[model samples]
Target: MNLFRLSKGFITEVHRLFALFWWESSDVEKRLHWGSWDKLCESKNDGGLGFCDLSLFNQAMLAKHCWRFIKWPNSLVVRVIKGRYFPTSDFLHATKCSSDSFVWKSFMWGRELIEAGSRWQIGNRSSTLIYEDRWIPRRHSFKVQSPRVLGRDAKVRLLLNTSAKEVEAILSIPTGSNLDDYLLWHFEKDGNYSLKSGYKLG
Candidate 1:
């Protein structure tokens, strides 16, 4: 279904199945509803059953596709999408072409989740623009608004070492021959997205 965004009607129909089980009813008959479905969807702390709202869960699941595309560019699906829609750039900066497919648009809708959890892991720094990309942990971008900011054209590649073995951003600009930087997800050790993590993000 992720080939396109699921329609509201489809989601509601799926929810109908859940509602049948929820109220201890069947498709053929009604049963007593102990509480509103919205209340059942609320967190336990909110005095409800903590079921994830299905609509939001659906979106989060779809957003997982976006997360996967960002972190796993080596995958076949990523390769296809990259070639088709974003050959010139990485997923983070990819803009839609007029020829975007339904799935690409569906994936694009989930881009915000990718932005929320990703930070550039500085490597060659070629793709990252200094002060423009978020790299320095905790601060959004370099946080340097001063007109006195150093070397306006600087890139993340400046943070590499002469040995090209380690980062050297402390006393001088890092310089390296590496050709690309990468996205790192803040929540996972492997930087992989899972349904559980996506739920947390939701």
Candidate 2:
């Protein structure tokens, strides 16, 4: 489930089996379902059995692979995939190709979930785009809401007015150290992606 994308029918069948087990139904006799499957999948705090939604769980598992791509860009798998599918671009910006393999396609599918929950943490600011990337510390949509005055290629560093000390209040702080800008899972305090959070987000 983590490495491959399961079909909807397969997941449905698995859920059906799970339901039978939960209700203690045998092959000879069927038991009445006490509640809807949706309710059963809800959190225990919300009066549910807290059963894992297989489809969402599968997505969460796959999202972990995508998260790994971002967290470990230098890994062998990422390097090979980058060389083949996105030689000139990155995982976030890569588009699906007609000739892509099944495994790569599955990884891309996982990437969609990663996109929903991940955001950029500004450090060096060279990679953090001022408008396109999510860097602003806002509630929803961590992007610049103002009209664009800078070019599309403008980085967060470009917005910093390091030339004047007084302009610091109006702009983002300058690159304090040599740390590189990186992606973060905003749902976690440690800024790391976890299956539990990914499942909930899904």
Candidate 2 per-residue lDDT, tens place, 145-177, comes to 667778888998787432343243325533575
**Most lDDT-accurate candidate:** 2
Q: Give the root-mean-square deviation of each candidate in angstroms.
A: 6.7, 4.6
List model 1 lDDT by residue over 30-117, tens digit each: 9988888778877787798887676667666777888778767899989987898889898878986667787787777677666765
Per-model TM-score versus the true fold: 0.64, 0.82
Q: Model 1 scores what on Cα lDDT? A: 0.66
State each model's CA lDDT, in order.
Answer: 0.66, 0.81
Top candidate, metric TM-score = 2
Model 1 worst lDDT window (10 residues): 161-170
